[model samples]
Target: MFKYLKNDIPASIVVFFVALPLCLGIALASDAPPLSGLIAGIIGGIVVGFFSGSRLGVSGPAAGLAAIVAAAIGTLGSFELFLSAVVLAGAIQIFFGVIRMGIIGYFFPNSVIKGMLSGIGIIIILKQIPHFFGYDSEPEGADSFIEKSGETTLSALAHITDNITLGSMIIGIVGIVIILFWDNILSKKHAFFKILQGSLVAVVVGTILQVVFSSNEALKIESLHLVQVPAPEKLSNFIDYLSFPDFSQIFSKDVVLIAFTLALVASLETLLSVEATDKLDPEKNVTPTNRELFAQGFGNIASGLIGGLPITQVIVRSSANIQSNAKSKLSAIIHGFLLLISVLTIPMLLNHIPKSVLAAILILVGYKLAKPSLFKKMFSLGWTQFVPFIVTILVIVFKDLLWGISIGLVIGIIVILVKSYQNSMFMKISEIDAGKTTKLVLAEEVTFLNKATIQKELFNLHENSSLELDIRKTRYLDYDVVEIIEDFLIQARNKNIHVHLLSERGNVDNPESFIEFLKLDKIKTNETN
Candidate 1:
């Protein structure tokens, strides 16, 4: 850990700046106290950092769970009651880790996973656009396709003229231009650009612009968003922000149900982020998923105890950490410390940093995750992969992130089932001496689902042909498939082809019904008999 700290310390500062607005934004979206998100980010980074086996994984309050958290607060009648559920969720995640359920992430199809990443990337970009123009009606980086302001993400963009702030827009455009210039040109110069991070430079510029514009007061640039860190005059005054759970609601069945839902969703989000962040890492080091869950459990417990939102390994923050060149868990720890220090000491300075700068940074992060090259790569994998992938993206863009993923997963499962049904049964026919002799082999197991494939294989037999169907090893044959086989026999007769059945247990007691059969002898049977 100490060895990793050399590079990680500076990286943490980058992650800290990136995480600050997100923490407040998500907390505001969830309708929880603005400080709760910060508390979660701090605990997730500092506490989980110590226990997590991941080098690049950064944990925090996730946007994926914001709707759930918001709804939970309403259902539970208080934010404190929701905290109780968060605590329960942590315990549940710990149970999952103990049971080694982390392997569940492996079962997710690659196409769906890629689709999820792309969807989230698109969402991040869309959500930040409004913030870039200094529209503060909605929280920054909210991913739901249906905007909180009652319109689609794209529509909100079209209506941006109504809510635009000239100052923030200017700062945002300048920040984007600087980042692009530094990344695309100056960084290659191998001079001062290497010493000065592009994003850091853009943020500084944005901050300076904000101060200058605010001082002038003549431009009337209203709606500029900033990080609002609650200040306490004394240590005792800080206690007002602390929230306690209402244990009286613990026994309610509704509370238990919501608690379990939170656990499940939070666990899935954490697992997904764990996988995604590992892929984003430049080192390509894999994090132990079970260990990650255990760490998340502890982090969530602490977060809830301190009146914070439920914690997960958030992909947005983790990606920022990776892009920032975070080297180890130390980066996560340091960022958490930065959160504590910034909120406690320099909140006024934080309040001065314009939202557009953060939006520009997130826009860059979004581009990296949803590059056009990714779409081409997915298409090259074929329709079996592309169908679900595209569907997931559309669903996410049109509906919600969770809904899109669920749709993709269902489609993926259906594709697998179709392939399995076709492959489970097979028939092969070969013609010798120009179709005089042929061989037909029944598959190991022929079920009703395989009737179409089997029928197609049998109908292709040649006229005046001698064929052999070997089914001696087959243990089970459904009646629907048997009927198809019998129908094929009739068709073969009309075509002047000989069909031979390979079976020892062909009692065929019910001549009209193909399913009827009994084993009179213990010996195996085949077409040779």
Candidate 2:
């Protein structure tokens, strides 16, 4: 872990800056104490990061769960009650890991995974646009298309123009310019430029601009547009921010239901981020998904015990860390320390940093994730892959993260079913002296999905036609398919169609029963599926 300290430290700083507004915003959105978000952020980075197998993933209070958290809190009648559910959720996640359910991440199609990354990227860029111009009505880290503010994601742009702050826009533009310049030019010039990342420099410039513009009424950024950390000057005062879970109701029916829901969603979000972050890593190391689940379980348990929102491996911070060129998990661990230290010692100074500077940094991260080249490449993969890929992006942009991915998964499944129906068998037809001659060869794997097509071809056979059924190449067969063939054999007798069954065991001029013949041949049957 110490092998890449140089790279890790610099990346940690950038991630810390990126995580600050997110922690505050998600907490506010969840209707909890602003500090709860930070607590989760700290635990996620320190505890989760310490145990996680992922080299680049950074965990925190995710925006994807804000609405659910808020609803859970409201339904449970108190924040303390919600904390109990969070604790229970952590236990459920641990159980999931014990059962090796983390393999769920591997089953997702590649197209859907890419779409998830690009969709999140597009969301980051669009959502930050309002903040870039200093319209901060919506809390930071709120990613849903429909916001608590009663405005849609795209509609929020309309208000930005009228509420735009010149100071914020100016600083935001400069921040973007500085980062781009430092990354593309100065960083290449010397190691000095590389150590002091462009994002840190932009934040410093943004803070100084806030102080410099204080004298001008039109230019000075208001407190609303700056970081809103709840600063505590003393250690004792900071302890007041912690909230403990009410464990009496931990086993209540409603609480257990909410816990299950949270566990399912949080695990899904974490696995998705793990997949996405690994892809973003230049080294392409595969994170152990089961270990990640176990790490997150402890992180949430710790957070809930001391008054914090639920946690998950977040793609945004992880992406920022990866883009900042973090070489190891040390970047994530140190960022947690930075959050703790900053909150304790310099929160007042941090509050002076304009949100616009952070917005600019995120915009760059978003652009990298949703680059136009990715679109062209996905399109080149053809419609079978592109349809679900594009659908995932649209739904994510219009709906939310889980909805988009789920719908994309459904689309992928449908495509597979259609392909199965069309390619279930190969047929050859010609006229013989006795009548029409039809030869049907089964596909490599026959499933219930292929039942309909097989039935249709058999039904279309002409009277007095001679039929040849070949399934020698089919390695796996479904019970539904066997039933369909059995029915066809019955129909053939009435239609006076001659039937021949060909298999590895040899040919039968007319097999009496499909099952008995297959049983004799010892063919594999996947009836359970």
Candidate 3:
């Protein structure tokens, strides 16, 4: 781990800056206290990092879990009660790990997985749109069909004018520009800025600007778009904010259901993130899924015990870690340590930082995830891959993330079933004597679904034509399909066409005997001629 210290340390600092705002944002989105997200992040990095088998997977307060947390809180009627569910979820995940259910992740098709990632990328960008434009009424990290503000997500886009914050917009643009410049220009020009990281620089600049603006009353900036942390004067006061779960609600069936939902959603999200992060690792390291689940379970339990938000392996922070050159578990470890130190020592410093700056960083993260090239590549891959990919993208963009993924999965399964059906049965014709004596061979194991196509081919035969259907290779024939074959044999006799049925276990000359011998219905194959 220390071998890459020169590169990894700098990367961890960058990731730390990137993670700081996300921790807060995800917590805010979940309707949990802002510090709860930070706490989760700190524990994610320290506890999960120490125990995780992943070389690059980063754990945090994931946006994907925001909906679960919010619904759980609303149902449980208290954030503390919801935390109990989180602990239960962690315990369940640990059980999943112990049972070695890691292989479940592979059951998802590659097409579906790609669609899922792309769909999620689109959702992240869409959900972050209001935040990027200085509108926060809809809640942070919301990617649901029905938003918390009682509007479909797109309708909220139209309502952005009503809740626009000028300070946030202005600072957001400035922050975005600073990040773009730093990433594209300044870092190339100066070593110090390169060392500091574009995100950190943008945060610093945003903080300085906030301070400068706050000093002047004429600027007229509200504190709503700024980070807020409870200032504690002493250790005891700080500890006062710590709360535990109200297990009194545990007896409620609703609470138990909510716990199950959290466990499933959190586990699935973490598994997907682990898959994605491993692909992004520079070293191409593979994370042990079961072990990662166990680590995440412990992290979530710790987070819940401390009034922190539910945690998962988050791709945004993981990607940031990769871009920041993080190596080994050390980067994650140091970043967690920094989280503890920063919240404990300089929360006021965090307050000075504008929300727009963080939004800018997230916008960058969003863009990275849903880059234009990804869309183009999907299109170029052809209809089978492209259709589901595009559908997933559009659905995610217009609908919700989960809905879009479900749609893509449905479409992908349809494609698979169609392909399988097409391959399940076939017909072979040998043209001889100018198609007069065509030999038609039926595929192995004919089913009812293949009847129509075969019937169509049979009807195309001319009067007095000869047709042979070889079913010796067929192990199982559906009753409906056998009936269709029997009906066709009668039609062939009437049309002056000769029909032949070849089966290893049946009488080939007597059609009815062939059917009876094959254990099919007592259908007549033909007059035993």
Estimate, for each residue in 1-529, the C-alpha lDDT of model 2 and write its tens digit.
Answer: 9999999998999899778767865665566776788889999999998999999999999866765686578679998999999999999999999999997766778888778778867876776687688875654334445565576655566556766889999999999999999999998999667656687788888889988988999898998788776776677897776789999999999899888878877998899889888889899999999989999999999999999899999987998898788999999999999988877887788778787887787678678878999999999999889999999989977766567788999999998888888888999998779478899999988888888889999999988889988989887777788878878888888999888888888888845665588755534444333
Off by over 4 Å in 3: 1-11, 67-77, 109-159, 184-196, 250-261, 280-283, 319-327, 367-404, 426-430, 436-529
User: Please, what are the lDDT tens digits per residue for candidate 3 over residues 321-371?
Assistant: 886777788888788989988988988777776767776776676677668
lDDT of each: 0.75, 0.83, 0.74
lDDT of 1 by residue, 380-431 (tens): 9898899999998888667655677789999999998787586755555565
Ten-residue stretch with the least lDDT total in model 2:
520-529
| Candidate 3, lDDT over the whole model | 0.74
How far residue 68's Cα lies from its native spot in candidate 3, in Å, is: 4.6
TM-score of 3: 0.77
Better candidate number, 1 or 3, judged by lDDT: 1
**Would you list the rank order by lDDT, best first?**
2, 1, 3
lDDT top scorer:
2
Model 1 scores worst on lDDT over the 10 consecutive residues at 518-527
Task: Assess candidate 1 and give its TM-score to the true structure.
Answer: 0.75
State the lDDT at 168 in candidate 3.
70
Q: Candidate 2 or 3, higher TM-score?
A: 2
Q: RMSDs, each prediction?
A: 6.2, 4.8, 6.1
